[model samples]
Target chain A: MIEAKNVNFYYGNFHALKNISMQMEANTVTAFIGPSGCGKSTFLRILNRMNDLIDDTHLAGECLIDGQNIYDKSVQVDELRKKVGMVFQKPNPFPKSIFENVAYGLRVNSMGDKSFIAGRVEESLRGAALWEEVKDKLKKSAFELSGGQQQRLCIARALAISPSILLMDEPASALDPISTSKIEELMYALKQKYTIVIVTHNMQQAARVSDKTGFFMLGELVEYCDTKKMFLNPDKAQTQNYITGKFG
Target chain B: MKHTERELQSLKEEVSQMWKLVLSQLEKAKQSYFSGDIELAREIASREKRVDAFELKIDSDCENYIALFSPVAVDLRLVLSLMKISSTLERIGDFSEGIARHVIEEDCNRMPPQMLEDLQLDRMFDMLTGMLSDSFVALESENTKLAGRILAKDKEIDAMYCNSIALIDRFLSENPSFIHCGLKTLLLIRKLERIGDHCGNIVEEIVFYVDAKVLKHGAKQNKE
Candidate 1:
């Protein structure tokens, strides 16, 4: 479970997220949707402290994972990140072999020995829904796989760390339609184990793949509710206008 | 306006045009029946085809809008309500055409004036016309405040329909020679009653579209 309590974030004095308080349940897919620069992705980044990587960025209020404030002084950033995995918009894989790409996470963490890393690599690939495609070519270069395959490889790389929550930032935006659909299907299957939170520009994809949808606008969360109600009969007129393509 | 807004406006206009045409058909049915105008009755029957054409066009257009736009919230509700309203209007058109046929087929001229007055045919026609036209205004204005009043008018039509049946039986008992014409008049009244019910249905759809409230199958029961 993940919860944000009155979470306000700033990027060098420009407020990017304003008083956003929401809870995402375990094992359910939650989607954040809005126009560009609306703070949906910013808020998602806040969940795993990805914003800490940037200069002059500050966050106020608690970002809780399982009721523990992750920003606490005693909390370890790397340990927090290990429990929260991320997949970016573009598939940025290491220029290494396919097996090495997945094994990279476990290797860096010194997680296991040779046989342990091999079994974990295969399990992560299967978890990412890319095992069968890349099973026979484990030693081949990661660049040999397609863009969609590379994205799934990144997902597998994240899974190799054994994270509890998966943060996807437009994970299918660069892929073709068929590949986008495959990624959407993977999200549905992945929710059985991971509490998936995704940021997307596509409204229909959010409606299709999420159990809960949060609509953000101009650094403010406009509405957050059931995906069906959000699409069919949203409570706010702003949400209705935005979803129906009436907003400027 | 946005592209979707323009398309929705065009769809609303199409449904409004069809509503007006169906209203004219019902009006002409009343005119032909009372004034014994066989020519006007024939015109109503011929224009029936145009009403059917309107329904087919509106149905397909709504389908295309859904496929092309995948509308949500109000736009989605409007498209769905428009489709159902068009179909309900087509059914009303069929009843009007059926009434027009009765005028051309039955010897309505021979029916005694006193008997026609007793049947309260003019009152029933006026009520149906008012109900249909008021529902049209309700939809056009995008205001469902008139829905309650418009829906209540159907109850009056139903009461008249019930009374007309008993009145016809009394008239038949007194004058057996007029039994055939009397029974046909009862059927005509039944058609008007049905039109009233369909008008209620249209009002329900308008309420659904404009207010996002489902007024069908007894609102209270549905809410419960």
Candidate 2:
């Protein structure tokens, strides 16, 4: 479970996320959708503290994972990240072999021995829905796979750590339609074990994949409700206009 | 100003035109029944084909708009309502044609003017026509304020329809010679009643499109 309580974030002096509060249930997919520069991705990164990597960024209020404030001074950022893994818009697999690309997370975190790592690598690949395609070429370079395969490899890399929550920032934006569909299917399957939070520009994808949808506009969460109601008859005029392509 | 908006506007206009045509058919059906204008009855029968054509066109256009735009919320509701409203209008057109058929088949003009008045048939036609025309206005204005008022008019039509049945029964008992004409007049009133019900359906759809509230089953339950 993840919850944001009056969370406001700033990039230098400019506010990136206004006072926002939402709760994402365990094992349910929550999709954040908006136009470009609406801070959906910013709020998603706030979940796992990925924004902390950038300079001059400030955050106020609480972002709690399982009721523990992740932004608290006593909270270990690395441990928090290990508990919450992320996949980016573009696949950024390491230059290592396909096996090591998945093994990289376990290796860096010093988790499991040789045999345990091998079994976890296969399990993570299967979890990402990429095991069968890359199974025979475990020793081949990750670059040898197609774009979609590489993206799934990044998903496998994220899943390798056994994180409780998966933060996906437009994980399928760069892939072709079939690959995008595969990623969507993978998200559906992954939500059984992980609370998936995704930021997508594709409204249809959000409608198809998420149980709950959050509509953000100009750093404010315009609406958050069931995916069915959000697409059928949203509570806000701005949400209706934006989804119907009538926004100014 | 957007492409979908323009397409939706054109679709709305097409339905509006079809609505006006159907309303004219009802008006002409009444004229034929009272004034013995068999020519107008024949014209109503012939124009029924045009009403059917408009329904098919609007149905296909709504389907195309959905496939092309994948509209959401209000746009989606409008397209769906337009599809059902056109279908409801087509059914009303059929009822109007049925009324016109009675005019062509029988000589209702022979019925005593007092008998016609007793049946309240003229008042029924006027109320039905007014309800239909007001529904048209409600849809064209994209306002549902007239929905409650327009839907209530159906009850008046129903009351007249019930009264006509008893009036016809009394007239038939008194003058057994006019039994055939009286029974036929009862059927004509029944057609008008059905048209009123269809008009109520159209008003429900207009409310759904403009206000996104389903009044179909709920309205019926309230009436019950």
Candidate 3:
């Protein structure tokens, strides 16, 4: 389980998130939904310490994964990133073969011999539902694949390291409906072994894929509940108005 | 997907219009049944076509709304409840029209004041009218406070129905010569009872739209 307690995040002088507290369970999909600039992406970054790469950022309160604070100095940043992988909004595959893209993380870590790396590559590709499409053309450049397939390759790259927690920031927003649906379906399949958290602008996508949904506004966590209740009858009027498109 | 707010508001108005038509249908049918007015009965029958038309229009509109906008949360609940509410209202319209037709065909003008009072048929119509009216008011205001009270009235109608069945059976044995009118009276009573049930169904749909609670098939409003 992942938990954030009274978290207040700041970028330079700007307070991006205020006193946000939430819990996300293992092997389930949790979605964060709000308008742009709502600090959802910033919070997702905090889980893997990706914010550490940004300059002049400050954090108050504890972010815990399995009862240990990830921000603790004793924890290595590179190690934490390997355990908590992320897939960004755009499908960014390097100028290399699809096989090498999945093997990149393992190769950087020098995880095993060439044969072991190849097995892990195939396993991660199958886990992301991309193995069949790319198996025959494993040596072909990743740019040869379509936009949706490229996104899946990025996901396979993330899963290659066997991360327990996966953070996705609008992973399907740039893709078409068919491609978006493929990504959504892939999220459902991956949640069987990985705890997934996604930031999305699409309310229906959140409703369709998530087990729990959190509604944010103005950097504040407005309401968090079971997905059905959040979509069907949210307790707060602000959440209702936002979801119903009555927000002023 | 665009202009969702205006489309939702327009859908609400359309459902309200259909609601008013169904209410007027029930009221006219009740008046014709009690007064044994054949002309008014014919009018009620003719207006049944309009209720049918409203049902068809509302169903298609909801489908189109879903196709175009893909509503969620309360917007989804409103469309879903409107679909069921319109269907229930249409069924109530049918029962009311059935009562009107029975009046036009039978000689209920001589249905004996004592027998009518014993069956509480007048009180049944009064409660059914109140139930339908209250459901519309609740829907208009988007409040479920009226739902509990409206649901309670259905129980009263059910009690009257149970009492009337025994009274009608006793009357049939005593007045063998008036058997035809007695059987027709029983049929009208049954129709009124069904109207009460359908109105309660509308109340349930109202509660679902306003509070997102499903109170069907013996489910109580949790209110939690």
lDDT of each: 0.92, 0.92, 0.89
Docking level for model 1: medium
lDDT by residue for model 2 (A125-150), tens: 99999999989999999999999999
Per-residue error (Å), model 2, residue A38: 1.3
User: What TM-score applies to chain A of candidate 3?
Assistant: 0.98
What lDDT, from 0 to 1, does candidate 3 have? 0.89
- Per-residue lDDT for A241 in model 2? 92
Error of 2 at A122 (Å): 1.7
Fraction of true contacts kept, per model?
0.70, 0.74, 0.96
Question: Residue A114's C-alpha lDDT in candidate 1?
Answer: 99
Summing lDDT over every window of 10 consecutive residues in candidate 3 chain B, give the lowest-scoring window.
B215-224
- Per-residue lDDT tens digits for candidate 2, residues B74-104, read 9999999999999999999999999888888
Candidate 1 per-residue lDDT over residues A127-246, each given as its tens digit: 989999999999999999999999999999999999999999999999999889989999999999999999999888999999999999999999999999998889999999899898
Off-target runs (Cα >4 Å) in candidate 2 are: B107-110, B220-224
Q: Which tens-of-lDDT digit does each residue in B78-128 have in candidate 3?
A: 899899988988898898788878867765446788998888877788888
Q: List the candidate numbers ranked by TM-score, top first.
A: 2, 3, 1
**Could you report the DockQ of all the candidates, in the order they appear?**
0.76, 0.79, 0.73
